[model samples]
Target: MSVSQTSGTDAVDLAIIRELSRNARISLAELGRRVSLSRPAVAERVRRLEDSGVIKGYGVHLDLDRLGLGLRAHVSLRPRLRSARKPQVLRDRLLAMGHVLSCVHVTGENCYELTIAVRDAQHLEQVIEQLSEMGDTTTGVVLSEPVHPRDVDIAAWLLCED
Candidate 1:
């Protein structure tokens, strides 16, 4: 039988995802009991979720500061010339930089928003110089982050009625 037959897009899937999101190491038998499915069924569904790219992979969220990464900066960059080609080239270069954790193409005056984690001011300055070579960038160092949600609302995203 298809994996969906064992566990399809129903409340069961949501429960499995929620449980897995909380602790990816949870045993299949425990997950089965929580989601009202057999252990084998739960395993099949989880496998399918992985294959489908829904459950990408499990990872440990680290404390960057504890790991000696003392600086977090959000950089807004404006391309020297507004063109599709320029942004792609700039993005490629930014992605190669070790300090850049994430780079997102965004709207507004800036073409890209980069989330950079670095050792200190000197490292941050080097990253800024590299990015600024292609485009102008405004860097804002993070002072404090009160909250950052680890889990996304999967049910809301999956079952949007609109």
Candidate 2:
């Protein structure tokens, strides 16, 4: 029932997944039409997908600029010697900060990489200052996203795996 095992799924299931990835809010009738299935059949298949853990959940994409948090930056942290042993403490602190969009633990000169959104330069400075208490921080402001975030190519990935 796992995503890589298409034995549990068929072409119709894959088609439904492709459509949902493009637009999760699409109506069931529309989804059925796109996949050549009845509405009830589509619904049942979706439920099966969910129950099998092939489809985890849906999420909303928010506009940071519209929310007045236009400044997006990436901060790389090389922990101070004292804090290097307990990375979880720093992770917990980041989880409490609303400005942190994502944090990844990495293998490199830097211990953690964080993506943060703030209101202005001052706000960005404030976030950096806070991070500095835990580690040496390097920050870079994002100019633009040329390639916007997108869904995974399910067929190319899950289907082609041997």
Candidate 3:
């Protein structure tokens, strides 16, 4: 596999990105007006951004509680043996599970960390049991989440000169 290199982004491109990040569904005319560009100019730039893989895609943020998934837990797995085969198999099994939202190969004492959401304690327990069957797992149920931002300040990081 080859990685494609992207051309350097200018101030105007950054401004356009900031505007789009604020509201992805904003009309091209409105966005161009905010960024002091014409609609066609903005459209062409957005098309380039998408083609160059700068703008991957757009997404919607949904509330887990509203979707009847109240219980959230973090499961840390420690493999019995440090073999490549068992770890890969365990990861594939976790990926197949519906309750496992995110699985991260992490550093430290644990091999993998999984973010899971379920309807209730019984459901969470079932997930835990399934995970335990694959390997030794330690689960921490989330009591509360203080901050979970959907969008981050990518413009600031991108603008900073290295």
Candidate 4:
């Protein structure tokens, strides 16, 4: 189920998610072993999680450099009133571009923040040009990712029985 402010997600569901996030490739048997459930039981749980929209599809983490996309950048964009490019229009445009990894509508000065992967500086410039059509953009190259994706904060979301 959706872990909204109202809907209460079970701790077991949280644990299952934590393990799955760590390794989505984990076999049902192994996952069951770790979570102290039978294979079928765990399978049922995972199925529910998926059906409930808690578990999305599994995907591989790609090494972009090996894939020929060496440059990674975050392009902050704010829509210009002079153009037909509003936030929704910009989102559609960004989604259509192959290099755009993620385009999230955010709070504050910028309307959108885009995570982009490209071949090089030249490629980044071309992408920036596309973004500029939609809005004013400030590009920042991601030099390092000190802390990346990890498990969700358990205490923050998971309400206790006590």
Candidate 5:
């Protein structure tokens, strides 16, 4: 169902979503307190959210730099595939690669955009070479990440509904 039509995602649920987005590691009691609900009430709401697919599985945010992957880059792929099956083949190849953090099929000149983490420039070059085999690649190394992931603006979504 569309989000606008979805039940149980009211202001309270939006508040819960906002809190969880900021920190998924928050305890149930803390989450409840933040949303001004009893722990059990909040738990039920959370369970409903999960069942409805409004809340997907939680995850960890790893520090790639701490893990020796000091370099991060965005790779834009413009496919050179002559056959229809070649795009799927490229996707499969990317899915199997450990360094590919995320790949998105996009509009415009680039068919796919990928975020990749690597140990250094050499590793980045190696990954780019692999990507080049499928299509032309334009890579931009990330100097700094001013905005991190998982910081969704749930309030803005509610505003847009009006």
Candidate 6:
């Protein structure tokens, strides 16, 4: 399964992306073996993928409980009527704050959705306190994650036109 990063990406490039998405730490030799290419060939494709920005950076997903970040919450921010804060300004402020795992600009009544990981209720409250200053926030603590984020679908990607 190859997920091309760009329009002109070929099968080998997509295959390389797919394998790496499954296991980023997989050895070049192992990846080559799986994709039926030599180590050097696989390495070249990986390098090309990186250069084209298909693969951004390799990362490890940590267990929040183990990391002492046991509390998880989504804070939805709705723009207030007389507030002069622009979205970019709010974004910059959000970026500066700690405990914000992911922040995305969205549509509808809410302007942004923020994923927060904190140590406990008090810590989460502190984050909410800050969020409230930015805008009116509706915070929801995550109870259980039924489905975690995963790799992209390479086959579906291949079927699409740029």
Most accurate candidate by TM-score = 5
Q: lDDT of each structure? A: 0.79, 0.86, 0.80, 0.80, 0.85, 0.80
For residues 35-126, what per-residue lDDT tens digits would candidate 1 score against the true structure?
89999999999998899887899988789999889899999988785552375766667667777878788778887888999889998998
lDDT tens digits, residues 82-111, model 3? 552275776677778788888888889888
Best by lDDT: 2
| Model 3 vs. true fold: TM | 0.80
Clashes of 6: 2
lDDT of 6 by residue, 20-92 (tens): 8788899999999998999998898888878877789999877879999998999898856344257667666
Error of 6 at 132 (Å): 0.5
Candidate 4 per-residue lDDT, tens place, 4-120, comes to 334445666677877888888999999999889999988999999899877879898889999999999999988785443465766666778779998788899987788999999
Which sections of candidate 4 miss by over 4 Å?
A: 1-6, 81-88, 150-162
Off by over 4 Å in 1: 1-8, 81-88, 156-162
lDDT of 2: 0.86
lDDT of 5: 0.85
**Which candidate, 1 or 5, would have the higher TM-score against the true structure?**
5
| Candidate 6 segments exceeding 4 Å error | 1-6, 81-84, 151-162
Whichever of 1 and 6 has more TM-score, that candidate is: 6
In order of listing, the candidates' clash counts read 0, 0, 0, 0, 0, 2
Better candidate number, 2 or 3, judged by TM-score = 2
Could you tell me which residue pairs clash in candidate 6?
2-14, 2-15
TM match of model 4 to true structure:
0.83
Q: Between prediction 4 and prediction 5, which has the larger TM-score?
A: 5
TM-score of each: 0.78, 0.83, 0.80, 0.83, 0.88, 0.83
